[model samples]
Target chain A: MVDDEADLAEAIGKALRREGYAVDVVHTASEALEITVYTPYDLISLDLTLPDGDGRTICRTIRAEHEHQPRILMLTARDDIEERVAGLDDGADDYLVKPFALPELFARVRTLLRRDADVAIGAELEIAGLRLDTAAHRVVWKEAEIDLTAKEFSLLRFFMTNADDVHSQEQLLEHVWDAAADPFTNTVRVTVGTLRRKLTAATGLQWIETVIGAGYRFVKEPVPG
Target chain B: MGRIRLPSFAETIRFRLSLAFAVVVFAVGAAAIAGVFLYENSTLVEPVIMAEKKIVRDLATGELTEVSVIFPEESQRVMAEKVELDAYRRALNSLRTSSFLALGILFLAAFGSGWFLSGWALKPVRSMTAVAQGITGSDLGRRIGMTGPRDEMRDMGDTFDSMLDRLEVAFDDQRRFVAEASHELRNPLAVARTNLELALQGGDDEEIRTAAAIAYDAATRMSGMVDELLDQARESLPVNASETVDLGDLARSVVQDFRASARQRGLRLEVRADPVEVTGDRLALRRAAVNLVSNAIRLAPEHSTVTVSVAKAEDGRAQLAVEDVGPGLTPDQRTRVFDRFWQGEGQEGRGAGLGLAIVKRIAERHGGTAEVVPAGDGSRFVITI
Candidate 1:
């Protein structure tokens, strides 16, 4: 768990522990990232607002380094519709707004944990001539390897995994960066743009399509032989 | 003079009724005074004049000498010009005094009657207002009873009660919708999550990857559903009265945010400036504009330009328009566009279908409106605020 509110973090950690899961609590996204480097976690409950940095950035960093990426559940007080959508789009497994009932919180954690059980822990994904190996953190398109920054790779992986769906910029921010990051910032756009350019240059194909006002859509339509 | 505060609902009812009562009492009092004056002039004073004339003739003809006059000289006259004049003056003086006293009594009676009558007439209304004020969102079912006749006040109360009934029903439906939608979304999300967890528990890499993908999809869909519910819930809230916002600047910022996406899609996104200003909730207005421009970009084909323009309309109304080069909506689609949850054929199941509806509601709340107009090979969504 990552949150600036010590009491809240402690309470959440206790609840998770009671649910039979080992819980590690941190007050800032930076600390959360530092801890995750040495100690692997199965699930991460993140608060978007933190004293040091945003949880979304930490989520991206973890997704980049870890072999089996832990599930993420974003906790935020801001209930704006766009913010929630942005959190989901960025790569968070789920999200809950503040003043949430504890039962609901526990339910969400259970749901995430149960879902993690169904997935093959370290499997690679391939679609539309693009390949992603989760264990290796490597991506290949049209038999050519693509090099991506930690943030870019996580973003591309999220896109390719959820192909043909529209994502809003707000969604991108939440799922791709620390929850504490400024939502109004256009970091997602700049990063996505850079990632798209790099992918196109490496694969020689236009895979990511802008859905206009909506967000972005990863079009996995195969090029004709 | 002391400052007078406007009366509360109860007080206002009492005051109005009292005023009406005072008018009626004044009219009746005036009629009574006129009747009294007429009787004194004709029946009493006129007959006395005739008798006095007969007595005066008898005294002149000497039929009786040294008559003992019970009345004073003025009163004994039989058309005695000087005496009649003096008698007339005395009678007029008495009449004037009596009339003045009667008027004073009538005014006092009228005021007392008005005060009591007003209180009596307004008792039910006061109670009804109190009952109405006690109602809250949770207890919208409570209503004032229509205990009186089918008069205007009763009609007004009945109308008010029925309005509350309608609101209660609407609120009930909304709450149910939110609950049902959330439940529906949760089930699928749970199933997907469970599957992903099982796959993760296994050591198979390919199965884990497939499970992860499915989980992500389910989660995304659930998020979308929740967002829709939230929008629906907020739609019914009263508009917030906040600081002024520059519509032009807001439009520009939203357009700029989407410019990169537009470029990536091989489309142009431009913001035209006219510096239209409006007073409203800046966040809401920005969201409205973002939804409009985003919708435009989605429909516009690659290489087509999407223009966002802000200016004052011909009617001195502030206007913000988002135009795009895409398949224009049919007349039917255009008509249904602003309707809640009404999506065009191709766009069905794509978005929450609440974007345009939200925009329309926001515009209406700001004493403005939104409409779709024909544009260059596409359509323009114009809002006046």
Candidate 2:
């Protein structure tokens, strides 16, 4: 975690370390850049405003220097819209505005860390007779191979990976779709609907359940017909 | 909207002009008539004077008798002299009549032309006034664009245009300062909110939790209400350290800050940015963009996404936009959204309703504007700076 405020930084570091993850706290932008250059850490919690330099520059420089970059989660006291956009553009994978809850911060860190470890963790996923091969970009349901668009494939993988957890259209867009995907577009909804219909047609089971105004949840149990 | 009054006799340039013309023509006509009358009178009297002088000489020499015949035709000379005198009297009367008639004609002609000529000469002034009248408080961007010979009226038009330009800038600066002031105050509140919420989590004991809740409520009250009041009281901040800023970069950074809150609420905050440059106070621009995006996220439904886009508008302006897929604003809502201290229906505790106003102000400072346009099932709030 990188922050200029010592007290806040220490608090965040303690909270993060309590989650059984090794954490290092740094004060200045220079120290942040130095540590990331030497150590190949799994994740970095970066502050936007620092003592020596700004956070966005540090994020960009680190991204350029490190070939296999750590998952960068920007921590900024500035919670305005454009600042957040700049942090993401500066190459941070995720961001948390200051005054954020420790649990919420941890959830984001965990999410980013899981993504970092995603490719290495497994090549195949099996849930409720539906199998997904992460490396091959393939899915099989009830002994039948299913055709999927790249986005649909990723959407299915995300749903399967975070089974029983609800996913919003926005979360799906961020995770499954490309960076250029417009958030205002209904593509996420349309793709999810198509993917669900296709999966149900293949196996006669609805794996993804709509939670209405909340979001979509991946059902662990069989469809309650 | 005040009515354009017909120029009263006292105020109209037309009247003043025509009066001046009429007075000059009348004076010159009176002088000419008097001079001609005097010359004619002198000529007529000169002949009479010569005859009278002859009679006086004859009387003195005893050659003239009142009732004596002086020749073969007794009354011939006397009758001839009487006829000559009568002819002079008729000529003098005719001259007097013609002199008055000439004066009347000239005066009428002078007044007619004076009315039309003044209108023609002041044509530029009238048009310049029309342009000025059209400028309302709602729209200050219009310029006279006056084109004409370089004269007094043109100079006036140019001066008015320059005045409007300065006024627009001054209004813009005032707006930017107001926006920045609110954000400056709110920053600490936002930070306090997070720290309080964090403190609340650490205490699982009921008493401690109660204490934390009180503190959280106090912060919320302070931030959501009191802070706004204080900000309004302070009104404006110093001129933001103006600099050349990358608008796209600034927008992206604000989105990064909202990412966590968006995630926690099951909403996704995403950004589409291009490297667009502009000269402005970076801090103020960021605050404006932040307000817009914050409004979007607050209004957007769960499972929906709030998208921020930064690019160059068609007019070569740096643009930042935040789109929400929530309930689109009503016509009334859209109109009133920028009004200071106005809250929407059911917007009791969210904010002090200064967000959009600040956005508008910031945009103005950058020589641009902020607007909300209806889209799909929501609204797109755009700031072109």
Candidate 3:
């Protein structure tokens, strides 16, 4: 989130973090740009007016520069049609006028994430014998429901979407974790290990395989009986 | 739409102008023709008929005698005089007829051309009327934009266009003021709502306390904004200008009011008075002075001096100025510093942002001007009436 109002930005960041989405907050366009250069965010809630620069220009520059496109949700005090149209035309994915409900913002964020994941809103993802409902945030191994933490759930969702493909620890860190995460940490491995153990305990099958000198990949199918 | 009802011919400017033109042309043409005729008549000399010498063969002397014979029945002088009078009468009659004919032609030509020329000349006025009638408060952007050589009609059009320009600007300012007011209110409202919502979410004691604190701050900001808005409205109201206000006294009172606050902030309040007086609202002028002094105290550096000066300028305008040893306004900021709700660079939520605007309003209400005087390393705000 980028807003000149530091208090509002902090409040929104705390709320999003409570919802299990890693969030980073900044107060100026320059700071936002400087940070986005290193860590690619999943979605950015940008305030239209900023002290250093316009949010639309920043959105446009992010779209032009980043290979991994981040969804831009513009937050503007102006509810006029022209402001919204200009923001969207300048590469904003959506806009929420100021003084909006927190619940509505959360819902829009969820929808944007689902869109980014290439899944329908509130749709259930089923691969082989594993089933996960994104809206309910539930996971079922075979017929047994498995409980998971927010991070584990996020990791599982990421692995399921890109099943059979290898993702390095850095890639997972960049995608699942926010810019605040330390790059040198083993949080990704630890979370992935925990997720694997949880899935194996439920179905008694090893669902994740680690290729030596490479990275982790989710098994697309259960082992043949 | 129904056609406009035309005024009577006599009531129309074109008709009156044409009639006036015809009258003038007739008068001048008749006088010129009559003068030439009179001059010709005055120069007409009666012809002299002299007695004729007749060589008559007398009955007795055949070829010797030549006699002057005058007829008794016909007087040669009278006959000559009658012929001359007849010729003069004919010439005068022709002259009179041609003169009248020429005068009539001149009057008709003058009236016709006058009617056409008047209509052509009034075309701009017609367009100006059309433009004026078509304009409304919401549609103030239309301008005559009349392009022509400088004339009375063009000057009127230009004046009208300039007036419209000013009106459009004022209207736009009003709209923007309302929008900014709403936006200002909404920002704090949003902050308060978010903070209260978070506080209600059953966070830890410290987190809840922080949320409540932020919410309280937002509420304070909203109240401040409301109060400032009220102050602005009050300042815009017509001041009771029946009383005389001494600027020196007003500045001293303002200085006294802000002295404690300045001392508390580790600042000095200095005063220079010259006993300048003006006829205006005393309360309004005091408010203006108080605003300037308070602003200077707020912005001036600690341990620096804020000088409140009241004097008559060189042109004999009564003036009150507050000079602060603070971060001076830049050229860009100077232009907009007096604008309503104009925030200083990165100084959001510091104040209600209407102080300068109110001061400006008060200054203008007294038929005066407010300005920021350039300083080497500080700022000075002056109100002169």
After superposition, candidate 1 runs with Cα above 4 Å error: A1-225, B1-163, B169-173, B176-204, B224-236, B342-349
User: CA RMSD for every model?
Assistant: 22.8, 22.3, 9.0
lDDT of each: 0.71, 0.73, 0.83
Candidate 2 local Cα displacement, residue B358, angstroms: 24
Residue B371 lDDT, candidate 2, scale 0-100: 90
Off-target runs (Cα >4 Å) in candidate 2 are A1-225, B1-11, B38-105, B120-176, B193-385
Residue-level lDDT of model 1, residues B239-307, one tens digit each, is: 776778888888888988998878887998888978877888787788789889878877788898888
lDDT tens digits, residues A150-176, model 3? 999888877876678898888889778
For each prediction in turn, the share of the native Cα contacts (below 8 Å between chains A and B) that it retains comes to 0.00, 0.20, 0.50
Give the higher-TM-score candidate: 1 or 3: 3
Real interface contacts reproduced by model 3, as a fraction: 0.50
Select the stronger candidate by lDDT from 1 and 2.
2
Q: Please, what is the TM-score per model?
A: 0.39, 0.37, 0.71
Worst 10 residues of 3 chain B by lDDT: B343-352
Off by over 4 Å in 3: A66-68, A123-136, A140-144, A160-165, A203-207, A218-225, B1-169, B238-242, B346-349
Of candidates 3 and 1, the better by lDDT: 3
Evaluate residue B250 in candidate 3 and report its C-alpha lDDT on the 0 to 100 scale: 77
Candidate 2 lDDT by residue in tens digits, A1-225: 787655456556655544434467788888888877765666778877564678888888887876657788887656667778888998989877655766678667656755733332455667777888765567987778999876687677677767888878876765555334677999988988898888888888878888989799988775833
